[model samples]
Target chain A: DVKVTQSSRYLVKRTGEKVFLECVQDMDHENMFWYRQDPGLGLRLIYFSYDVKMKEKGDIPEGYSVSREKKERFSLILESASTNQTSMYLCASSPNRGGGNTDTQYFGPGTRLTVL
Target chain B: GQQVMQIPQYQHVQEGEDFTTYCNSSTTLSNIQWYKQRPGGHPVFLIQLVKSGEVKKQKRLTFQFGEAKKNSSLHITATQTTDVGTYFCAYGQNFVFGPGTRLSVLP
Candidate 1:
């Protein structure tokens, strides 16, 4: 079975603090993504990495960045946490497809971030 | 950019009743996918529809894609306790899901 593991299931941080959320998928998928989910707004993409060192901005990417230094791990970074950023963060990975958005994405258990 | 919208943000039904959720998109879709996420759990893939006007079934669940490829639906024959979850429909070149329909089943 494919497993996508998150570094933390819950986190709390103070305003202006830098935060990191880590995700690892053991299935060797090449495409990974970060999204934030909130009540009413649903899930919005923040960043995605298709390969090591390659990244792309999604619909809502402000104040956030991602790292894909290795094939199995992806990280989401909040440059300066704020109360408005508190939400459930999800990490997803899919097999690489040269074709756009045509692959099946597997998701990890989400991290609920609470920024004070 | 693609836009996928789901209807009836929330639904409440009695066990053994039928339930359905609809999804519409602004543009034609190469494929449409469905997912279910239980409360406090990650979203899991339910099925994918590739052809226009396609319909597929999984036991008590039925999935349909519109003829124009811009809409889709998921119908449950008889709602059960296990069917309580948020159902999402994603339309795109790939498999990005949209806002989901949250279902609550009552005994």
Candidate 2:
């Protein structure tokens, strides 16, 4: 089975503190994504990386950045965390861009970040 | 921007009853995918539909992609406690998920 693992299940940070949420996939997928889940708002994309050392901003990439130094790992970083940034952060990976038949997206358990 | 929306953000149903959720996209999608995320768990892929007006079934669940490839639906034949979760429909490149329908199955 494809496995996606996040570094932390729960994290708390003070305002203005830097935070990092790490995600690692064992399937060697080429695409990785980070999203924040909120009630009623749904899953909003924060950032995504298609290849190592490459990243792109997503719909809600205001205070978030991502890094992909290795094919199996993707990291989401918050330069200066704010209370509004508290959310359930999710990480996902797919074999490739779902252009043909890449429908499946394996996800990690998620990190619930509490920016106080 | 490619966007998708799901209707009836929350649904409450009794066990043994049926439930259905709808997803609509702003643009024509190449394909549509369905996913289920249990409470406090990550999302898991359920099924995918490619062709226009395509229909696929998995056990008690039925998934359909509209003829316009801009809408889709997921119907569960008989609701069960285990069926309680958020159902998400995504359509676009790299499988973008919608807001999701949170289903509460009451015993």
Candidate 3:
């Protein structure tokens, strides 16, 4: 089974602090994504990496960034934590796919962050 | 920009009752995927529909893709306590997801 794991299940941080959320997938997937889920807002993508060192900005990319240095690991970084940034963060990985393939995504247990 | 929307922001039903959620996309989709996220849990992929006017079933759940490829629906034959969760519809070339629907089942 494909296993996606996140570093933290819950976290609390002070404002202005730099934070790092790590995600690793055991399966050799080519695509990795980071999304933040807020009440009523749904899962808004922050960043996605299709390959090592390649990244793309999603709908809500501000206040967040991502790094994909290896095939199995993706990291989400918060340059400066703020109260408004508190929410549930999810990481997902999917195998490479062409048009029409299902390429279903496997998600990791989310990390709920609270910025004070 | 593509938009995906799900109706019935929230639904409450008794056990053994039927439940359904509808999803509409602004632009025709190449494919549509459905996901379920239980309370306090991450979302999990349920099914994906590709062909226009396609319908698929998984035990008690039925998924249908509209003929125009711009809408989809998921219907549960009988609501169970375990079926409680938020159902999300994802579309677009980039798999942009709809806001999702929260379902509550009363036993």
Candidate 4:
């Protein structure tokens, strides 16, 4: 079974504070993604990394950055946390099939971030 | 970027009742995937349909892909309390997910 673990399950931060959400996958998948889920908004992609040091912006990447220094780890950085940034953060990883076919994503336990 | 739309933003059903959710796309899709997210839990992959007009079933749940590959539906027969959660339909390689249909099954 694939295991994806996040650094924190729940986090609280103050406005303008720097926040980091970490995700690690044991499957060594080549594709990793960061998403923020809000009510009625579904899961919106924030950033994704296809390989080490390779990053791509998703639909909503503002105020957020990603780091993929290693294959197993992906980090989401909140430049300066704001109340509007509070949402459930999810990390997913999928193996590279090297084709146009879509791969199934395995998700980690989400981190619910609260910005006050 | 592709858009996937799901109907019945919310549904409440009593135990043993049937429930269904629909997902539609403006343009044809190569494949579609379904996911379930329990309350306070992250979304989990349920199933994927690649072939058009394909139907797959798991236990009492049925998933169907439209012949046009532009729509899909998930149906759950005899709902159980454990089935309460949000159902999402995703499309495209980027996995653009729908807003999701929240299901509440009352025992």
Candidate 5:
């Protein structure tokens, strides 16, 4: 079974504080993604990394950044947490099959962050 | 960028009732994938359809792709409380996901 784990299940941060969310996948997938799920809005992609040290901005990347120093781990960073940034953050990974099509993505349990 | 739309943003059904959700796209889709996300959990892959007018079934769940390749539907028969969750349809290489249909099965 593919297992994806997140650093925190729930987190609380003060406004203007920096927050970090980490994710690790044991399946050795080459593509990783970060998304923030909100009510009504659904899951909005924040950022994605296709390889180590390579990242791409997704639809909503204004307030978030991502890092992938190793193939097995990905991290999401909030430079300065704000009330609007509080949401359920999810991390997912998929194996690259050499096609443009995205395969099934295995997701972590998710991290719920609250910016106070 | 590709996009998919889901209808009936929310649905509430009694146990043993049938439920269905639709996913539509303005343009022809190469393939469509369905996912189920239980409350407080992550989305999990359910099935994928590529051929036009393809129909696939998993026990009580039936998924159908349109002949035009622009739409798809997921139908659940005799939905149980375990069937409660958000169902999403995604397409394209970027995997643009639909807003999802939240299902609530009442006992």
Candidate 6:
């Protein structure tokens, strides 16, 4: 079974505070993604990484950044937390970028962040 | 930009009732995938449709991919409480997800 673990299940942060959400996958996957899910907005991509030290901006990358120092771990960083940034954050990893078929993604439990 | 859209944002149904959700993409998709997310849980991969005008079934659930590769639908026959959650269609070259349709099954 593929297991993806996140650093926190629920987090509360004050405005202007920096926050870090960590994700680690045991499958040694090459692609990782971070998304924020809102009520009606669904899941909006924040950032993604295809390899170590290689990152790509998703649809919504502003106010969020990602780091992948190792192959199995990816971290999403919020430079400054704000009220509008509070949402359910999800992390996912895939085996490779379209090796044969690559739409399947394994996801972490997700972190619910509240910016106060 | 590649985008996916789902209809009927929320659906409430009694046990044994049928439920269906539609997904439409703004651009042609290379392939489409379906995911289920239980309330308060992360999304889980369900199935993927690669060919145009292909239909796949998993027990009580049926999935269809449009011939144009621009639309898909998920139909549940005799939905149960276990089916309660959100259904999302993920498309695009990188799998951009739709808004999702929340399903509520009443016992």
Clashes of each: 2, 0, 0, 0, 0, 0
Docking quality class, candidate 5: medium
Per-residue lDDT tens digits for candidate 1, residues B1-107, read: 77889998999999999999999999898998898999999888889899989999999999999999999999998999999999988656435668889999999
* Per-residue accuracy of model 2 over A1-116 as CA lDDT, tens digit each: 99999999999999999999999999989989999999988788889888899998888899888889999999999999999999999999988744356647888999999999
Name model 5 segments beyond 4 Å from true.
Answer: none
Write model 4 residue lDDT over A1-116, tens digit each, in one string: 99999999999999999999999999989999999999989999999988999999999999999999999999999989999999999999998888778889999999999999
Shift of residue B85 alpha carbon in model 4, Å: 0.5
Separate DockQ for every predicted complex: 0.63, 0.71, 0.71, 0.90, 0.76, 0.75
Find the candidate with the highest DockQ and give its number: 4
Error of 4 at B78 (Å): 1.0
Off by over 4 Å in 3: A100-102
Q: Could you give the CAPRI-style class of model 6?
A: medium
Model 3: per-residue lDDT, tens digit, A1-116?
A: 99999999999999999999999999999989999999999999889988999999999989998899999999999999999999999999998876646478899999999999
Better of 3 and 5 by TM-score: 3
Model 1, residue A101: C-alpha shift (Å) = 6.1
**Model 4: lDDT of residue A94:** 91
Please tell me how candidate 4 rates in CAPRI terms: high
Task: Give the DockQ (C-alpha) for candidate 1.
Answer: 0.63
Instruction: Calculate model 2's interface RMSD in Å.
Output: 1.5
- For model 5, residues A51-88, the per-residue Cα lDDT tens digits are 99999998999988889999999999999999999899
For residues B1-107, could you state the per-residue lDDT of candidate 2 as single tens digits? Answer: 77788988999999999999999988898888899999999898898899999999999999999999999999999999999999998766555779999999999
DockQ-sorted candidate list, best first: 4, 5, 6, 3, 2, 1
TM-score of chain B of each: 0.95, 0.96, 0.97, 0.97, 0.98, 0.96
Assess each prediction's global lDDT (C-alpha) against the native: 0.90, 0.90, 0.93, 0.95, 0.93, 0.93
> Can you write out model 3's per-residue Cα lDDT over B66-104, one digit (the tens) per residue?
999999999999989999999999875456789999999
